[model samples]
Target: MIEYFKSDARLLSPLYEFEPGCWVNLVRPTSEEITHVLATTGVEEDFLRAALDPEESSRVELEEDQTLLIVDIPTLEESNVEQDESKIFGTLPMGIIVLPNTVITVCLQDTTVLRGIAQNKVRDIHTAMRTRFVLQILLRVAGLFLRNLRMIERDFTKIERRLYDSLKNEELIQLLGLSKSLVYFSASLKGNEVTMEKMLRGRILKLYEDDRDLLEDALIEIRQAIEMAGIYSSILAGTMDAYASVVSNNLNIIMKVLTVITIIMTIPNIIFGFYGMNITGNDLPFAYWWWVPVVISIGGCIGAWIYMKRKDLL
Candidate 1:
């Protein structure tokens, strides 16, 4: 879908007409829609297709007439939580093509930052300038990464508590899922940082000094996100290991208690078996005496207590 917005105001007209500060937001546009955008704005077809490809590497390239900036944006599948490993959650391809008169964005899925920008929540004073718009987009992406990092941290905190309360295999699986998400985010953020740095120093975009400062701020945010992801992953891995060990120890204790009980019970069975055997002196000794049972009961109790105390099962 193609939507046009001018500084926080949505335009209803199909015709692309706007003053200096407008942004054209594209979300999951079809081929014909992409052709229409390019036809209206004079953007290159290859540039648009490059942004549409999911496997496109994050980079910034300049053609004869326009600059193509491809960056990785962290995205999660719908209805997916941090612990859903089977869910599709990773970086998506997002493209920004800066033409002389307009700036066009292409992405496979919708982005919250783009929506916010179109809503005027993130105001851009220079909407007419494509380079400025591109920089603003980069800033928005960096902000999104930071937001995702915070969310991951909060999730880790909750899961960590659960791990301590009751360490189970299911909880370990959830932790693994969270760790995978963090790893994905970290790699994507690092790639984005490199692309932004290239844009800053390459001067292909010819960004103004003030815009350069904005890009620098975005880079810093990306770096912070990468660092936060690393820390969270490390902490989560350590917690998982510790919890697994704890679970194993608990199982060992349970098994030891059951084993000790079985051993104590077997002592009485052995004594009864010997007396039950048909022997010549068995009847004369104490076979019919009630004291024999009493003696066996006392011995069993004493043996069980001693074994339990020695094994720390009591």
Candidate 2:
């Protein structure tokens, strides 16, 4: 779908008439719409197609009188229903095409930050300059990463509490999920860092001096997010290890109890087996069968007590 927004707070028609200082946000644009954008902006068809490709890497290509800046934006993974644990979400591909007169953004999925910007919910902006708008988007992306990291931290803490109380497979699975999410976040931040470095050094975006400061701020936020993700990843890894050890220790205790029970039960079984095996002329002459049973019962009790005491199973 294609949605066009102008700085004057007017929503354009679906035909997407070219205008200055307007943002064209496309989510899963149709082929005809793509052709329209290309034809209106006079951008190369290949450049437009490349921007739409999800697998396209982050790069900057300077076409005559235009610049194509493709950046990878981080996005949260959707929760999976089949698995007990959540799955890690990967980065979404986003395209920022800067024409001399307008800036166009294309992505496959709708992002919260973009939505907020589109709705005029973000403050301190009467008009959207191409450079400032891009910087705002970057800043929002970084902020989202930090926010996601915080959420993951909160989840880890809850999981850790449950883990300390009792070690379960589900807890481990959740820890794994959190860890994977951190991994994804870290990777996306690194990609963002690289893209930012290129933008700063190459100066292809013709970013203003003030906007450079904003980019630096965005960079700082990205770094902070990366650090937070690293810390959480470390904590989750340690927690997982500790949980595994606890589980192993619990299993050992259970096995010891069962082993001791087996040993104690074996005494009576062995004694009965010996007595049941009748040899010729082995019977007692007194015919006091009660005494035999009493003697065997005493022996079994003594044996069980000694075994219990030795194994600390009492």
Candidate 3:
């Protein structure tokens, strides 16, 4: 899908014609739409292809007069129906192409960052101020990371509580999934930080005082996200370790109880085995004396029990 927008009184209003100082947002563009954009906008096909490739890395490139910037953005997808967890999240690449009097954003899927801009939730959005607009998008991406990270943290905490009473793989599976997400976010945030730092130091965008400040703010947010990912990853790791220890300790307790019971049981078996043996079948000591073994077995069991109790093995 493709939509065009122009700044209208601090809001993004849909545009019906190809206008200068407009924003073109594309989501999963078709081949024909791709060809048309290529022909009309004169943007090289390489940039569009990279944007369409979901596996593309985050980087900045220059082709002719346009600057192609790709950044990875986080997204959530529902887990399989059989999975107890509701959703899992990861990053996908988003492309931003800076052209004269226009800026184009292309991504494989719709994101909150774009929707917020469409809804006029952002304070100021002037298409003519392309550099600042890009900064704002970066800022929104950073905030989105923080928002999603908090959600992951909360969900993991809930799962942690569920895992307290019982050991189940479903909850741990979800934790593993979330941990994988944090790894992606960490890498992407680092990539975006480098890109932003380069922009700050390089002449890619002519930065005004306000633009510089906005860029710095976005940079700070990105750094915060990086830190958040690291902290969450560590927390998840610790949780896994704690659960492992709990399980190991429980197993030890179970084995010890079973061992004590077996030893107590063996005492009776020893008495029965010894009493059944006889040198002469008919001349056995007290021929009709089956009760003798029973009394002996009972006495032996009691003795074993007393010994174990004293030793605290029970």
Per-model lDDT: 0.76, 0.74, 0.86
Q: How many backbone clashes does candidate 3 have?
A: 0
What clash pairs does model 3 have?
Answer: none
Winning candidate number (TM-score):
3
The alpha-carbon deviation from the true structure for residue 21 of candidate 2, after best TM-score superposition, in angstroms, is: 1.9
Candidate 3 residues 69-130, lDDT tens each? 89889999777536565357899999999998789999999899998898898888998789
Write down the lDDT that model 1 would get.
0.76
User: Per-residue CA lDDT of candidate 1, range 1-314, in tens?
Assistant: 88876543333223355333456667888888887877777778898888788888788888997888888898875423444433324788898888777778889888886776665566544567667778888998998888777777776777677777767566666667678788788878878888998888847688788888989999999898888889988888888778878888888989887887777778878777777677865564676786886698678879778867986775
Q: Worst lDDT window (10 residues) for model 2?
A: 8-17
Tens-place lDDT digits, model 2, residues 1-314: 77777765333223256666677777878999998877776767766677678777777778887777676676777655445444455677787777777777888888887788777777644234777777778888889888877878877777788786767667777777778778777876887788887787746787778889989999999889888888888878887888888888888989987887777777777766655566643474333364775577568868787968986785
Sorted on TM-score, best first, the list reads: 3, 1, 2
User: What C-alpha lDDT, on a 0 to 100 scale, does residue 309 get in candidate 2?
Assistant: 90
Q: Which RMSD values do the candidates have, in order?
A: 3.2, 3.1, 2.0
Give Cα distance to truth, residue 106, candidate 2, Å: 0.9
Q: Considering only N, C-alpha and C atoms within 3 Å, which residue pairs clash in candidate 1?
A: 20-128, 21-127
